[model samples]
Target chain A: EAGVAQSPRYKIIEKRQSVAFWCNPISGHATLYWYQQILGQGPKLLIQFQNNGVVDDSQLPKDRFSAERLKGVDSTLKIQPAKLEDSAVYLCASSLGASISGANVLTFGAGSRLTVL
Target chain B: TQLLEQSPQFLSIQEGENLTVYCNSSSVFSSLQWYRQEPGEGPVLLVTVVTGGEVKKLKRLTFQFGDARKDSSLHITAAQPGDTGLYLCAGDPAGNKLTFGGGTRVLVKP
Candidate 1:
């Protein structure tokens, strides 16, 4: 079975520049998520989409970060006027359903590494 | 905000040795998940414990959930170079959204 797919495995940009990462989740997965992972740290959720509708974006840095999932399939995360601290790996993940209870199995992409100098 | 804390941010050990990582949180969770992440890849699920005081073992790796459902631990027996990676514990207290710990990076030398 095909797993989550991400593009631009690596990205390098200067501070104040813009960058975007793309993610295509597994077929039939109803829940998709975007996470920011700093070096030597665990992944932090930037946004979550359930069938094209956002479920939670409480931790998203709205001023500079934005994400959207179209047709509940592929998703895109954008960072505008990026900052030096924005250097991190952007990871995309998908789960089979939108279960509100118990443990959900998530399949993640290889991730896109972003470097802001 | 819900927070999960992992201890001993990094660990280095020789092959055939044993090591344990801990994850703790003040809030209760319905379930907890453990993941292993390599240098360039996203994390892969190692195990999930739903019941309090639950213990699950997969080969040389064993996971235990605290009785209060607020903590978890992972122990590796006879570690190998292949075991080198970041170990993360996560929980979802507000339904579907998962909150992750800081992660423990383990280096098992051959």
Candidate 2:
């Protein structure tokens, strides 16, 4: 089966601009996640969705970063008025399920590299 | 928020050498996972340790979860050039929320 898929492998934009990234999770996966990773840091969760419903998004930068998984199979992330600090990689991941008993493994996409100049 | 700290931010070794990376957390987690990430790609799961004091092996890699469920370690035997990359450890709080460590970069030169 194909792994998670992401678009616009790379993006370059000036500060205060906007950018959007798309992701398609593995078939049948019910959980989706969006993460932000700095050059040398671990990925930080921005949002998570379970079958088209949001589960968690407390870490998201609500002011500029927004993500939605309309049908639970595909998702999109948008960053408006991108700040210089927003230059990083946006990663999409999916899992079959998640809960106390269902600690499923996650499959991640190649990610969208954003460069805010 | 749960936070994980990885030791030896970077490691450089020769082929056939052994190396160990540590991930520590102050909070308990229902499960823990280890991932290897190469340049220009997302991380790939190496192993997941669920039970406390559990040990799982994958090829030349060995993973151990602490008895306290707040720490884990990854050991690579006979490291090779192909093993050079970033190693990340993530802790799941049973809510499906994952907290990742700072990550350790390992470079094995042949």
Candidate 3:
């Protein structure tokens, strides 16, 4: 019954630098997601992965942001040449990947807080 | 992108007070979830309301979905210090994609 796990609980870097966050979802979970949470806003989905394939990534900043879930167990979210606006908490979550009509409650990680100077 | 809006961005109440937070959207969703988050942790799911006009209660907390399926509300009675946190509402537009509303930060002072 371990929850989702993420690395680097806090990160500080200068603008134009690249940063990456890692996540390990709960055991047996088949769906993973990456979200960006600003200072006073809710978590915004950046991308979603159903197994090894991506389900949705329309909100991701393609020019600077990229995510991969190799083998569908672990995930990595990267931002190149980060901007000041990119400073936010990066949260990772996982679910059972069941349909909306089914039971698929999400389990979230503590999140990695990024501070771009 | 579907937009979810939450009211009273911030609220502060004394212990034993009752408060309600709302989440609204113009677009319909298949399901909506409510979560509460502390300062340093990710959000924890509080409840999910799918059926329109459905009411679910968890202890002193009550969640209600609008008849139109585009809105939801969370009511807390006899709030305590442990109730202080950020409340977020997220709508599932599709099977796995979620759209979140700007959260409501509640502070219950003892």
Candidate 4:
């Protein structure tokens, strides 16, 4: 089976520039998540979508970070006017939404590494 | 507020050695999950512990959940180089959202 797919394995952009990362989740998965992971730290949830409807995005920096999972299959995370601190790996994951035990199993794709100058 | 804290931010040991990583939190969670992430990759789920005081073993790795449901640990026996990765513990506070710990980077030298 094909795992989650993310485009542009790596990207380099100057500060204040705009960049976007795309993710194709696993088939039949109803839940998708976008996470930001800084070097030497764990991934932090930036946004979550449940079948095209956003479930949570409280941690997302609305001023600069935005994400959308249109049609509930693929997702895109965009950072406008990227900041130097925005340089990090952006990870996309998906899961079957069910019970607590069932929902915690997340299948993640190789992340998109971004470097902002 | 970050709900999870992992101890020993980094670990480096030779093959065949044993090591343990701890995840502590004050907030009680319905379930806790452990993930292993390699450099340049996203985190991969290793185990999920729901019941308090539950213990699960996966080959050379063992995961234990605290009775209070606010803590967890990962233990590796006769660790191999293949076990080298960043270990992270995540707690589900609610609504399918996860709070991740700081992560512990493990390096098992061959």
Which candidate gets the maximum lDDT versus the true structure? 1
Model 1 TM-score is 0.97
What overall lDDT goes with each candidate model? 0.94, 0.92, 0.92, 0.92
Query: What number of backbone clashes does candidate 3 have, counting pairs of residues 3 or more apart or in separate chains?
Result: 0
Over A1-117, each residue of candidate 3 has an lDDT whose tens digit, in order, gives 999999999999999999999999998888999999999989988998998899899999999999999998999999998999999999999998655565357889999999999
For each candidate, C-alpha RMSD in Å?
A: 1.5, 1.6, 1.5, 1.2
Write one digit per residue (lDDT tens) for candidate 2, span B85-108: 999999887567887898999999
lDDT for model 2: 0.92
Worst 10 residues of 2 chain A by lDDT: A96-105
Ranked by DockQ, top first? 1, 4, 2, 3
Compare the candidates by DockQ and give the number of the best one.
Answer: 1
Q: After superposition, how far is residue B36 of candidate 3 from its true place, in Å?
A: 0.3
**lDDT tens string, model 4, B1-110?**
56799998999999999999999999888889999998777888898899999999999999999999989999999999999999999988776887799999999999
How much is A99 displaced in model 1, in angstroms?
A: 7.2
Q: Candidate 3 regions off by >4 Å? A: A99-104
What is the per-residue lDDT of model 4 for residues A1-117, given as tens digits with 9 covering 90 to 100?
A: 799999889999999999999999999999999999999888899999999999999999999999998888999999998999999999999988756464467889999999999
Q: Write the per-residue lDDT of candidate 2 for residues A74-105, one digit (tens) a residue.
A: 89999998999999999999988764645668
Better of 1 and 3 by lDDT: 1
Model 3's i-RMS, to one decimal, reads: 1.6
- Candidate number with the higher lDDT (1 or 4): 1
Task: Write one digit per residue (lDDT tens) for candidate 3, span B4-26.
Answer: 99988999999999999999999
- Using TM-score as the measure, name the better of candidate 3 and candidate 4: 4
